[model samples]
Target: MNPFRYERALDVDHAVQAASQGGRFIAGGTNLLDLMKENVERPRRLVDISRLNLDRIEPLSDGGLRIGALARNADLAGHPQVLRQYPLLSSALMAGASPQLRNMATTGGNLMQRTRCYYFYDTATPCNKRSPGSGCGAVGGCTRIHAILGASEHCIAVHPSDMCVAMAALGATINVAGPQGRRTIPFEEFHRLPGDAPQYDNTLGEGELITGVDLPAEGFAGHYSYLKIRDRLSYAFALVSVAAALRLEDDGRIAEARVALGGVAHKPWRLPDAERMLAGETPGSRVFARFADALLEGATGQGDNEFKIELACRAIVRALEQAANGTPQSQVDKRIA
Candidate 1:
């Protein structure tokens, strides 16, 4: 890793001030440290926010929850309020890395996590995200883990966070503070497509630091499923993951539905129109399959990832079925059903 100055922040204001001088904000240092070692992120300074008072997970008067940016993934998954009101988030967190990494990965860090592709991490190859103006190697290189949706000619990288996918499905809001002031960003608008600038992952402004996340009152806790399909049963990134939530009417018809896809796009792939198509419709394979097709529209893969199109469609159907049946995939058991 490169030599860099390290400063421990005393509070939120201190952290933002420290980062205003081109210093990068780091909490938990789980992914940042690895990237530094690989020479992917070489910052002149690192402002540590681990000791800041931003680790609490509290309930809101409106029945929602406000999660601190520094809250560890493990703590957030196990919090009583989270398990009771937002089990989909808990399931996604559990489906992520091992317990040791979870203890060190914070909520804000996960939100700020960068997109990953074979060439982005391999310094020897050309990667537009890693080095702007350098050709995108992922366009023809190993694309098994690359994006299929919202991919531009400049890059085809995919975000690697199970937690973000679930949060997108639940309609979580991001809270941030910067030199300008504090602001809230809707989850759908936080992460953006590659477009022409593949280097910038999200719309977070310069010197802004995420403070917390707001989960709306309706979490669809009773009918939710987080399904991850990876090469291995544990400790591997997903090939295609699905977070499905539903509200069943008293007549057994679908009142509402939400489906967010991971390992398939630059952000948690969600389409409000596809979700609206399921409203007031009957829950069945036909309905869910059509919804999947609508969500996957315009999704053209690079090469090896073409299989992901069908895989994502089937996974979406299976996830929705599990949600409707009230049988969420067990994170501990590692079984499909």
Candidate 2:
């Protein structure tokens, strides 16, 4: 790791002041530390906010949730309110890294995580996200895990976060504090697509600190699923993951729906077309197939990951089916050989 100065923040104001001078904010240090060790991220200073009083899970008056950014993944996943109300989020969190990692990973850090692209992590390789204006090595190189949607010629990397996928589907709001002041950002607008400027991941401003996320009151608890398909499953990054939520009327007709895809784009790819198609349709294989087709309408994969288009289609259908049947994974779903 590169030599860097560190300071423990006394509070949110202190954190903002300390980080306003181009220092990186360190909470759980799970992702940032790894990047620093790999020399992918070399911050001159780290403002430690883990000691700040930003670690609480409170219920909002409007039946929503106010999750502190410093809340650990394990605690957030296992929280009674989360498991009972936001099962989709719980499942997604549990499907992510191991227990030890979950214990150390913070919600804010997870939201600020970088892509798991091999080229981005390899200093020898040219990656636009890593080094601006550098040629993208994954464009024509090994792209089995690259994106299939919202990918620009400059970069084709995908965001790797199960929690963000569910949060995107839930329409959460991210609260941020900065040198200027505090503001809230819609979940959908938080992360940006990898356009020409692949170097920037999200829409966060300079010297901004993520304080927490606000989940709306209306949740898809009764019918929601977070299905992650991977190579070996346990602790592996997602090959294709689906976060599905459906609110079916008493007559078995869908009243509302939300679907988001991970491991396929720069951010959690929301399927608005598929969601519209599912609005009035009944839950069935035929309907699910149509939903999946709508999701893949504009998807074009690279050579090695061309198979992901079809795989994502099948995964979407399966995830929706499970969600409709109210059988989202409570634990990690693995196929034992």
Candidate 3:
């Protein structure tokens, strides 16, 4: 690892100020440390913000939840209120890294973690995301895990955070603090799609520090599920995953639905078209299939990974059905052997 100066932040203001000096903010140091060791990320200074008072989970007056940025992944996932209320979010977090990592990872850091694309991680390979104008290797190289939606000619890497997928489906908002001031960004707009600038993954400006995440308590207070389908049973990234929340009407019809996907896009993919098609529709295989078909329109998959399209669709259908029927456990299998 490269030699670097380390500083511990006394408070939020100090953390933001220290971070503004071209230093990378380190909370859990789960993702950043790994990259630094690999020589993928070389920052001159490291600002340790783990000591800051950003580790609270409070209930909002508007029936929502405010999750602090420094809150550990394990704490948030195992919190009584979160498990009892936002089961989808809890499930997504639990499905992610191991128990040790979950204990060290933070909510803010989880959202900011970079992609797992081999090309992007290996400094030897030319990747636009690592160095703009360097060209993309995953475009024609190993692309089975590449993105199908919101991809650009510059890059097609998938966002690797499972927590963000749940946040997108839950209509969460990001709270940020920077040199200018504080600002709130919708979760959908937090991460940007790879357009011309694949190097920039999020809307956060340089030197901006994420404060926390706000989840609006609207729909899905009752029924919700997060289903991740990967090659391995545990400790593996998803080939395709679905986060769904559904509410049924008195006549057993869908009243409202929020659906978002991961492992298929540059960001968490929300399907408004699918949501619309399922609204007021009965919960059945046919209705779910129709919604899935509408969502998969225009999806371009590589030759080796074309099966992801069908796998993603099936996962979405099963997640919606499980949520609508109040099934706490998913019946879908996760096998690639």
Candidate 4:
């Protein structure tokens, strides 16, 4: 790692000031430190904001959750309010990384973490995301793990945050603090799609620090689940993942639904068309399958990852079915195990 000066922040204001001086904010250090060591990220200074009083999970007056950016991933995932009211978010967090890493990782850090693209991490490979105009190595190289949606010719890397997937479905908002003060950004617009400017990953300006995430309450409670498919059983990134929340009427007709996808896009992929199809319709395997098909429309896949389109569709269908039926724990265990 390059030699850098370190400063412990006293508060949000101090952190923002320090960041304005070309210093990188350090919270969990799970992602930042690794990138710095790899020489993928080099900062002259590190501002530690772990001491800031932004670690609370407060219930908003509007019937939502105000999650502190400094809140640890494990704490946020295991919070009773999150588990009961926002089960999809909890499930997505639990499906990510491992217990140890989650214990140390923070909500804001996870959202800002860079993609796990092999080329971006290796200094030897030429990647536009790593160094603009360096060119892309994944275009015709090994790209099984690359994206199929919202990808440009310069970058095919998928966003790596599982928590953010659920947040996207829940209509979360990001609160950012910077030298110029504070501003809120909608979750959908916070992470940018890989367009011609693949080097820019988010709407956050340089030196801006994410303060917290606000999840606005919607009425899609009781029916929710997160399903992640990977090559291994545990502690692995998703090949394709689904975060779904649904509401069913007394007559077994869907009243509402929210769906977002991960591991198949440059950002969290939400399908309003699929959600619209589910509304007022009876929740059945056939209905869920049809909705999944609608969601996968226009998905362009590469050679090796063409199978992902089918796998992603099936995963979404299965997740919706599981959420609708409230499958028994034993049955779910058998199926997943």
Candidate 5:
């Protein structure tokens, strides 16, 4: 890792001021530290925001919740309020790394974590995301774990956060603090597509520090599931994961739905068309399967991951079915493919 100056921020204002002056904000250090070791991120100065009193998860008056950016993943997942009111978020958080890593990973850090694409991590390889205009190695190399949606020829890397998948499905808002002022960005809009500039991951402006994330009142409480498919049962990045949340009428007709896919795109891939199709329709394999197909309409995989298109479709059905039946898989139970 490169030599860098470290400063502990006394407050949010301190952190923002330091960040605006050309310093990266460090919280959990789960992702940033690793990137630094790989030489992917070389910040000369780091402003520590972990002590900035932004770790609380507060209940909103409107029946929603505000999660501080410094809140740990384990606390967020195991909190009673989260399990009761936002189980989708809970399940998604628990589906991530092991207990030890979860204890150290923060909400904001997870959202800011870079993609796990092999080329991006290996400094020896030519990757556009790693060094813009260098050319993409994954485009013609091994791509089983790359993206199928929202990918350009320059990059095919997929976002690797399971928690953000649920957040996208829940329609959360990201709060950012910067020199200008504080601003809130919709969760879906925060993470950007890998367009011509594949290097930039999100819409966060330079020197903006994430404050917290706001979950809306309508979280689709009871009916939700986070299903992750990986090469192994645990400790592996998702091959294709699905976050499905549904609200059904008393007559078993779907009233509202939110579906997002992970490991398929540069950002959390939400299927608005599939959600629209599920509305007013009964939750069944037939309809879910058709909707899944519709959701994967423009999906095209690289050589090795061609099977992901089909795997994602089936995983979507399974996740939706589990959500509708109110039988979300326990965090400990890993489904082997």
Candidate 6:
């Protein structure tokens, strides 16, 4: 890793102050440190925010929950409130890295985690994300884990955050503090699609520190599912993942439906029209399959990853069926139930 100055932030203000002056914030250091060591990230300075007083998991007045940025993945997954109110998120977190990693990964770090594309991590290859203006090697070279939807000619790397997929389906709001002031960003608007600029991941401006995330009261806790399909069962990044949440009426008709896709694009993918198609309709294989078709309408896959298009469509249908039947996929089972 390149030499860099280190600073331990005393508080939020201190962290923002240190970062606004061209310092990168480090909390949990799960994803950031790895990139640093790989020479992919060579920040001039690192401001440690791990010790900041921002690790609270509290209830909101609107029957929602607020998750602190510093809250560890393991702690958040097993938290009583989270398990009770947002089990979809808990399941998603559990489906991510191993127990050791969950113990160290933090809320903000998970949001800021980079893609796991082989070319992006390999400095020898051309990766637009790592070195802008350089050609995208994943476009034609080994695209097994690249994006299938919302991909541009510039880059096809996919975001690899299970937690984000769940959060997107649950309509979570991200709260951030910056040099100017504090603000809240809608979950869908936080992460951007890689059009021409693949170098940037999210819309987080300079010196903006994610303080916490707020889940709206309507979590669809009664019915939700987080299903991740990976090459390996243990600690493997998803090739296709789906997060589904549905609210059924007393007559077993769907009241509301929310679906978000991960490991398929630069950010968690959600289509409001596809979700709306399920509203006021009875749950069935035909309807869910139609919804999947609508969501993947414009998806085009690169070579070697064309299978992902079919896999994502099927996963979406299965996840929605699980949510509608009140049987979310069990992470321990590892089978498409």
**Which residue pairs does candidate 5 place in steric collision?**
none
On residues 4-73, what C-alpha lDDT tens digit does candidate 5 reach at each position?
A: 9999999888888888888998888988999999898899999999888889999999989999999999
lDDT, candidates in the order shown: 0.93, 0.91, 0.87, 0.87, 0.92, 0.94
How far in Å is the alpha carbon of 333 misplaced in model 4? 4.0
**Which of candidates 1 and 4 reaches a greater TM-score?**
1
lDDT of 4 by residue, 1-337 (tens): 8899999999889888888889889999999889998999989999999999999999999999999999999999889998778877887888889899999999999999789998999999999998999899999888888888878888999998899999999989999999888999999899988888888889998789999999987725578778888887678787898888888889988988888999998899997766898889988889888888888888878777878899998888888887887641121242541
User: Which lDDT value does model 3 have at 241?
Assistant: 87
RMSD of 3: 2.1
Model 5 vs truth, CA RMSD: 1.2
Provide the RMSD of all predictions against the true structure, rounded to 1 decimal: 0.7, 1.4, 2.1, 1.8, 1.2, 0.7
5 or 6: which has the higher TM-score? 6
C-alpha displacement of 319 in model 4, angstroms?
Answer: 0.7
Across 166-225, the per-residue lDDT of candidate 1 in tens digits comes to 999999999999999999999999998888898998998888999999999998988999
Question: Per-prediction TM-score, please?
Answer: 0.99, 0.98, 0.96, 0.96, 0.98, 0.99
Compared with the true structure, model 4 gives a TM-score of 0.96
Across 1-337, the per-residue lDDT of candidate 3 in tens digits comes to 9999999989878888888888889999999999998898899999999988999999999988999999999999888888877888888898898899999999999989899999989999999998999999898888889887778889989999989999999889999999899999999899999899999989998789999999887737577878888887778888898888988898989988888999999899996766888888888888988888887778888666778888888888888877877874442343311
Using lDDT as the yardstick, the better of models 1 and 4 is 1
Off by over 4 Å in 2: 333-337
**Model 1 / residue 8 / CA error / Å:** 1.0
- Candidate 2 per-residue lDDT, tens place, 1-337, comes to 8899988888898888888887889988889999999999999999999997788999999999999999999999999999888888988999999999999999999999899999999999999999999889998899999999999999999999999999999999999999889999999999999999999999998889999999998789999888888887688899899999999899989999999999999999996756888888889988999888888788998999999999999999888898888887555436411
How far out, in Å, is residue 89 in model 6? 0.4
